[model samples]
Target: MEKRLLGKTAIITGSARGIGREYALRMAKLGANVVITDIDLSAGKYKETDIKAKSVKEEVELLGVKSLEFEGDGTDESFVKKVVDDTIDTFGSLDILVNNIGGTGGAGPGLATDMEVEKFRRVIDINLTTTFIFSKHAGKVMKVQKSGKIINVASVAGFVPLFVVQPHYSAGKAAVISLTKTMALELAPYGVTVNAIAPGYISTVKWDAHFEAQIEDLVQKVPLGRIGTTEDCSKVIEFLATDLSDYLTGQTIFVDGGLMELNPSSSKIENYQI
Candidate 1:
């Protein structure tokens, strides 16, 4: 059997570690030449994170495909544009782009009342603005090619109010979903499909410290009674990145173990009765 993404080229931001690294690895496994772009860089040599990117690159290379590592802030307009240009210059063309760079401004989750304005702005810049920059530049390239895949990494917080306490991060992710739909609508005519993946409680190295306790609580809340893995999220992305989803666009798929479908009213009533 042949790989689903054979001969494709992909640019996955934040590919240094965590979910982004998983995306790079999974795409490469499918025979896609991946560009691992991250904001983190080392001084003398590639750090552990960069090593992860290099390892994926090596694995892909072993499969007879090319890979590259790029270090830069995905939110910067010039940097993002240059990444798109460099990928085309080096690989000859661009096929897929995964906007996987985002976080809670390093503050974890905080109450809306205590969140600072600057922190809120920074979160928006990192999550929402970065998606815009990549989509805008990559959209142009894909339009010219007349065929491309743009997958924005959104969060389940975008659909429900799960991250309401962390207003900034929640708002930013919500914007990502909205932007995904808008881009999908605009790019549909150009033969390009744009979609968003909204993942919930995915286990990554970044959350390893509190993984166990968080998983227990999260599982109790989820209908599936389990937290998601990086592979779980990657599977949905694989579908969106291929012709398997050619007719699907302007949509957000939540890979949350059915967490979003739960009835808040029923749960609340049960709690009150108890």
Candidate 2:
């Protein structure tokens, strides 16, 4: 609302759809040149409320901010390095990095007993490892600049074991929270702030039928009386990317509509003393 991100540049991964897309739009709206990448580059394919990188880039341009779109894997170090380098080459500065390129995206049953070793590894690679790879490169540039912001997308499962049976997803997100804190601590002296958003029951187009049917029940369980939205998390990303949150670092801000407060059994809430 304040054009808070003016004169900055950001890279947001997995920005083809959902929360990543929203974050990209919000960043651009606030005047940040954006570099967005999603493995899926199709422009109009997900017309049924799908947000493609092409469409996202177009919107960024419409907002009057420079944008570059890429279709690459964030888990690949080479790919990450190239994008970060290219963003610096083009924008001349790397002011922000939003690691929105994560999710459960599991194909097998999410239960630990039913989860395959490959599935567990894949989930971690996509969610946690990607954050590590991307942040490592971005951190280097930000360190030289002596300023930057990094935001990673974690989930409520990372804090409290959800009833939906996603052990692999839970583990991956939990690791992301840890990664955020360690990065925050490592980067603070250089003026970089690292944080993670643990979203709970966020509404997106790519949900299973069961989640759609159980929406009402899930809302009741949430103390806020409604499912979280992409904008809810994007707003927090906006804060972390700007100077408004300068005093905050190595923090995992829960954007779960008070769900974690209601469920105190989580060891995660205590694990993050950073």
TM-scores of the candidates in the order shown: 0.89, 0.91
lDDT of 1: 0.80
CA error at residue 202 for candidate 1, angstroms: 0.7
Cα distance off (Å), candidate 1, residue 190: 0.5
Q: Give the runs in model 1 whose Cα sits over 4 Å from its true position.
A: 41-55, 263-274
Clashing pairs in 2: none
**Top candidate by TM-score:** 2
lDDT of each: 0.80, 0.82
Tens-place lDDT digits, model 2, residues 1-274 = 6788898999998887777888999999898999988877562356536443348888788888999988888888898999999999999999989998776664444566766798889988888999999999999999999999999988878877675456677788999999999999999999999988888878876643447767776677677778888899999999889989999998888898888887444333222100
Clashes of 1: 0
**All candidates: CA RMSD in angstroms?**
4.2, 4.5
Worst 10 residues of 2 by lDDT: 265-274
For model 2 the local lDDT of residue 187 reads 97
Per residue, candidate 1 scores C-alpha lDDT tens digits across 237-259 of: 89999889989999899898877
Cα error, residue 113 of model 2, in Å, equals 2.6
Tell me how many clashing residue pairs each candidate has.
Answer: 0, 0
